[model samples]
Target: MNFEAAKTLCRSFPGVTEDTKWGNDIVFSVGDKMFAVTNLGEATGMSFKVEDERFLELTDRPGIIPAPYLARAKWVYVEDAKALGDAEAAELLRRSYELVFGKLTKKLQREIGGA
Candidate 1:
């Protein structure tokens, strides 16, 4: 998905927050923990968490690679924003949001109404 679409999808999730980080990156977070990130500069790429089991499989795909500095955590960076179809991109992003949200404390989850 492109940056605008990604932004919209991420903001639709419960308790999601958007912020500009590192001057050229846009980050999407839930309960203060990031789940997605995209570039604000010339590059067209997006990164988000993925299930551990799917990391290697995803990174092996063309236009997709292990996210820099976050590969150990199973995040994948989509080098081409349109590499995955819209539906697939949406699904991955939703999964990323769920994974991060699941890590939040129960109380925080409840406070965010995402439990």
Candidate 2:
């Protein structure tokens, strides 16, 4: 998927907020915790949290790698937007949102109507 499509998919999730961080990266967060990030200048790469079990499996694929700086937290970077189909991209993004959301405090989840 392209950057716009990825941005739109992230925005569709409940309680997601988008902001520019680190000068050029676009971050998507739920309850103040980031779930996804993409570069502003190019669609060269995008990063999102993945299930711990899937991290190694995903990184083994071409065009995908363990995210720099955040790899220990089980984030994966897609080096090529076209590496994944639209449906798969959407699913991974949604899962990223869910993973982050699940970690938020219950009170915050209630405030976001995400509990």
Query: Per-residue error at 71 for model 1, in Å?
Result: 0.5
Question: Which pairs of residues collide in candidate 2?
Answer: none
Instruction: Give me the overall lDDT of model 2.
Output: 0.89
What is the C-alpha local distance difference test score of each model?
Answer: 0.89, 0.89
What does candidate 1's lDDT look like per residue over 1-115, in tens digits? 6666877899899999989999999899999999999977554889999999989888998999999999999999998765788788899999999999999999999999943
**lDDT of candidate 1?**
0.89
Alpha-carbon RMSD, each predicted model: 1.8, 1.6
Q: Per-prediction TM-score, please? A: 0.92, 0.93
The residue-by-residue lDDT of candidate 2 on 1-115, one tens digit each, is 6767888889988888999999999999999999999988665689999999989888988889899999999999998776778788888989999999999998999989843
Measured with C-alpha atoms, the lDDT of residue 10 in candidate 1 is 92
Candidate 2 local Cα displacement, residue 65, angstroms? 0.5
